[model samples]
Target: MSLIYPPLQAPKRLLFGPGPSMVAPRVYQAMTQNVVGHLDPFFFQVADEIRSLLGYAYSTSNQFNLAISGTGSSGMEAAVANFTEPGMKFALLTNGFFGDRLGEMARRQGGEVVRLAKPWGEPYDPQEGREFILRERPQVVAFVQAETSTGMFNQAKPICEAAHEVDALTIADCVTSLGGMPVLVDENGIDIAYSCTQKGLGCPPGLAPMTVSPRALDRLKARKTPVQSWYLDLQLLDTFYTGHKYHHTASATLFYALREGLAMVAEEGRENRWQRHQRNHQAFVAGIEAMGLGMHVQNPAGRLWTLNTPRVPEGVDDAKVRAWLLEKRGIEIAGGFGPLAGKVFRIGLMGHGSTEDNVALILEALADALKA
Candidate 1:
């Protein structure tokens, strides 16, 4: 077959999907600047500034905060591979797909995985997990703070408390939670937490911002055997992220973009940014209910501020409606994952995408798509 060139310009999309919410203009501008060597003095300063912002974003004073040169899933792998050894018991609280994925990755690294599960659209109960952990007594308890699959926000305080009661380290997936809502990693007693740039941070995906608490760091240093994944090994990464030992080359351009994004976040102010998402969610929920659509997670308090999973109305093809909205209105949403697929539509109100105009536009487009 002859080679074919694609269109010169891509279609303009209003991203209101699972992640990769709309990017701020400054972040976009940052990426278009002239490139610099990864180890250039100015780029090194930029990287250090990004790390400081990551510390603030994660709401921790951790000295080990830094961005991995990969997606959020890579951050999960790094967390698991660093703290877990072969044949050691690791506990997971699985309420959605990502939580289960964490358990799977841990198992692949030779962890004896034990899962505590709830239904697909429900949140895992920390009290129940506490009882199970007391019995299983795993070395680590891992879970997703915001279960993106079902739009359920897993409350971390009680879960972290439960895990600590059993003397297990806590690893939280804050991929969808970091910027939209309050993470409070230090106050919540989370041993390790990982997030991505694309979701609430309002930047294109590239960096996995993570923080490992001092306790978790100590556990890694005390591990009986060396971690298996060399690329994701915490020992080498720690030297670079914590001690500035320069372990591997990092992308200076993406760090520039990330720095710009974090600056935007600071300008908005964390509390105000969080309030914007919550207010937008409330407005959207009201609009969706007015259109007779039910939410998948009935408890409003348990719903995620960043991602909303609304039940697909009866007699509607979920994917068909999504396609209609995208084709006709340039709006993009997501369908549910795993067992929740086709049952709900996932709408994101995050970062720069979380605005009254975007919310209204999406609701109007969804209404039109449903009627057609």
Candidate 2:
């Protein structure tokens, strides 16, 4: 007996959701290149180039920078697991979902979690974060530089400074900001920073590009207990990346895609790419305001260039609007989470997806959806 399956035909969508943004044609082409064994010499050369490019992307000189063989969440887990131990004090600055997730990961690692929370869609004041860090005296301080859940961008420099004052390591989640904005891991004093390839890098979601400062690496080296996650252990990963040891099988295809994406970033110039995102974001905001819609993030400084959360109009059906956009226009925008549910639309303009054309199209489609 023979079984028949339908041919895979995925819809061509203008992804304006929180993540997995549109990939560049170059990245797709890179993925189609011939695969190599994870431990092959040729693969090692690819890995070396990726590490170098990742450092450029992260704006860091740290030799520990490399792409973890998992999604953004894996990078989160790795950062937490390596730096935390039982009964350690971990201070998390939270205002949205991803911040809360860092707290959860810390707790799972037996960290005595201390959370300093601000209202959703708001950025934490640097002074307040400093006070919290001093008061909590945590061994590790974690926060999201770009809060994807709320479309807010937090000030990282002051937070890192405060953490350092307390002799604490700072972990920054740059998943949404790395390629789109200036993460400046070294300048901001971030000890460990992790990001995803899909959102800002214009690649498929698979690799998590991460960097660890010397201070963070020293802390990891001095850990009393073994890292909880065997696969995500940084020491083991470091050995693998440094010594060409076989710790695990990493896909060469994904590495190819990541390299190609990073190459694009380098070619465009990081600052120029950031300005492009900012320009597109400003255009989107202007269009939304013209349509009589308000933004969810009130503070101009708090707003993220890549992710935009426009308030759902009063008496308008949020789900219906999202559905109509998807069904009629083939555009995919997301709804809010937790306290923000049904109150706002989470639209992303990231990487190759961030364009003047997309901004205009989405605005027009959104206007039509609202009217219908």
- TM-score against native, each model: 0.96, 0.98
- By TM-score, who's the top model here? 2
**What does the lDDT read for residue 275 in candidate 1?**
93
**Which residue pairs collide, candidate 1?**
none
Among these predicted structures, which one has the highest lDDT? Answer: 2
Candidate 2 lDDT, 1-372, residue by residue in tens: 598888999889888898889999999999889999999998998889888888888899999888899999999999999999999999999999999999999989999999999888887778888999999999999999999999999999999999999999999999999889889999999999999988999999998999999989888889999998889998898777899898999999999999899999999999999999999999999999999999999987789999999999999989999999999999899999899999999999999899999999999999999999
Candidate 1 local lDDT, 1-372, one digit each (tens)? 798988799789999999889998988999998888765778768878887888888889997887888888999999999988999899999889999899899989999999999988787666787788888988999989998899989888887888898889999999999899998899899999999999999999988888989889888889888789877777787676545567678887788888988888888888888899999999999999999889999899999999999999878899999899889888889998689888999999998899999889999989999999
lDDT of each model, Cα atoms only? Answer: 0.88, 0.92
* lDDT of model number 1: 0.88
